[model samples]
Target: MSARHFLSLMDCTFQELQSLIRRGIELKDLRNRGVVFEPLKNRVLGMLFEKASTRTRLSFEAGMIQLGGQAIFLSPRDTQLGRGEPIGDAAIVMSRMLDGMMIRTFAHSTLTTFAAHSRVPVINGLSDDLHPCQLLADMQTFVEQRGSIAGKTVAWIGDGNNVCNSYIEAAVQFDFQLRVACPEGFEPNPVFVERAAGRLSIVRDPREAVAGAHLVSTDVWTSMGQEQEADQRLALFHPYQVTRALLDQAAPEVLFMHCLPAHRGEEISLDLLDDPRAVAWDQAENRLHVQKALLEFLIDPAYQHA
Candidate 1:
C-alpha cells in the first residue's frame, strides 16, 4: 500500500493505521536514543500553507529534517497559487519538482483536488474539516501510555470541530468507545458522526459522557475564524470545560489531552493540563515521529520500512 497522501482517517484501513502507529512508536524510540536513519535521503517535500499554523508547520518541517529530507515552505503570498492559479495546476507543478506535498489549508475539497491531480503523494497537514495527522499522533500516544486502546473510552468535551472529528474516526479505527459532549446545537458534523455511528456515543451532558472514560480530550471553545463568537461560545461551553471537578467524573486513571495552543482557563483548567496524568506534551512530541514515519512511507524508494 502506498502512503503518499494522508487525506483523512476514513481513507485508511484499520491495518494501515496500525502499521503507521507501530512505525511511529519505533521511530520515536529510535530518535530518543539519538539513532538516525536516512530513509528519505535527498528527497524534497513541498509545503504549501494557505492557512496559518504553529504545530503543523514546525512538526512536518522538523520531521523531514530528522529523516534526511528537505522541505520548502510556500505561503499564500509566496506562490502563484495566490494569483488565481487553480489548486490542481499548482499541485501538478509542485509534484514534478518535489518528492511529496504537505498542504495546510481551508477546504478538504482543495486537498482532495490536489491529491487527485498530483503525481506525488499529498499529505493533509490540516484542513478546516479534518486533522488526520493530529489523530495519528493522538492514537500513538494512547497506545504508548496504556499498552492498547481498544475498548477504552475517550471523552471529548468541547466544540465538534476538526479535532473532535478526527477523534471519532480514530475511535472507529481502533474499536474504542468514544463519547462526545457538546451543547445541544454544537454536536459534531452529522455526516461524520453518522458514518461512524454505532461505534460512537453523543451526549449533551459533559459529566455523563465523561463518566467512566479512560481519556478526556478537549479543544478550544472558539476556533480560528470563530473568534467572532468568543463571548457567546464562552458562555455556551462553560459547563463543558475539563475542570478538576469534571475530571473526577471519569475513571480514576483518566488522563487529560488537548491539541495545544490551549486557552489556559477556557476549554481546560490549568490544574488539569499540568496534572501528572496529562500526556499533552508526549502528544506534541509524537507529532514529529509519526510525521517522519509518514514521510518515509511516502517517499522512500526502497520499501524496507517506514
Candidate 2:
C-alpha cells in the first residue's frame, strides 16, 4: 500500500478524521489515568523545520518520546536541504532512514515535493497554505470542552492565513458552519471558500459573524515571513480583534481559541487569555495528545485501526 501523507485536512476522509479525534481523546484519557501505551516503540520520526517554532517543536518531539519513539529535529542550518539540496533528494534519503517525517516550512509546494519523493508517511507540521496539525489539536480541544462540533457555528475573526484556511477545511470534515470576518483583501483562498460552498460565509463585520457562534477563533495578524507587512496588517485587522465584547456576542457557552505565541494586544485583547471563555491553553496542550495520536496512526501498524 502507498504511504499516507497528511499535508492537508482534505487528505483524510471525514470518517478517518473523526476516528483520529476519538482516538486522540482516548489517548489523553489514558495518559491521565496513568495507563502506559507505547505503540510507536522503536519507531523514529524526523522533523525538518524551515521555520522556527515553539509548540510545534515541543509537542511533536515530546509526543514521540511519550509514545516510546524518538524524534530527530532538523533545521535548515543543520541539514543539506537548507544548503541547496533538492527537496526530492533529501526526502528520498530521509525517508529511507526514518519511519515518518514531519516538515514545518514556508511554502506548501515544499511539502508536496518532499512528500512526492518520500517512501514513508509525510506530515505537514505547517505551511503557508495550511496548518492542518494545529487544526487537529483545535478540533480535539473543541470536542473535549463542548462535545461534538457538528451542526455548530464557528467564527474566524482575523487574517485569512494558514490557520483560517485549515479552519475552512475543518468546517467540511467536522460538519460545522464557518463564519469568517476578514478584511476584503485578507479573505481566505478563493478556492477553499468555493470548496466549502454552503458551509462557509465571509463577512466584513466581526460582530455579525460571532453572533450565536459556538466557537470563536483568530490568529496573529502578521504570520512568519511577513514582518514587513505588520504595520499594514494591524491597521486592517484592528476591527477584527477577538475582545471580551466580541466573545459575549457569541453563544452563552461560546469558547475562544488562538493558536499561540499571541501578541497580547493585537488579534486578541491583552486580558482575553485569562477570561473563562478563552480555551487557548487547553487547545495548546491538546497539541501533545492529538499529535501523539497522529504519530501512532501513521507509524504503528497494529494501532492504525485503533
In order, candidate lDDTs are 0.87, 0.93
- TM-score for each predicted model, relative to the true structure: 0.96, 0.98
lDDT of 2 by residue, 110-177 (tens): 99999999999999999999999999999999988889999999999989999999999999999999
lDDT of 1 by residue, 23-45 (tens): 99999888889998877878999
Give stretches of model 1 more than 4 Å off.
Answer: 1-3, 304-306
Candidate 2: 10-residue stretch with minimal lDDT: 297-306
RMSD of each: 1.5, 0.9
Most accurate candidate by TM-score: 2
Tell me, by lDDT, which candidate is best. 2
Report the lDDT of model 2 for residue 211.
99
What's the CA error at residue 100 for candidate 2, in Å?
A: 0.4
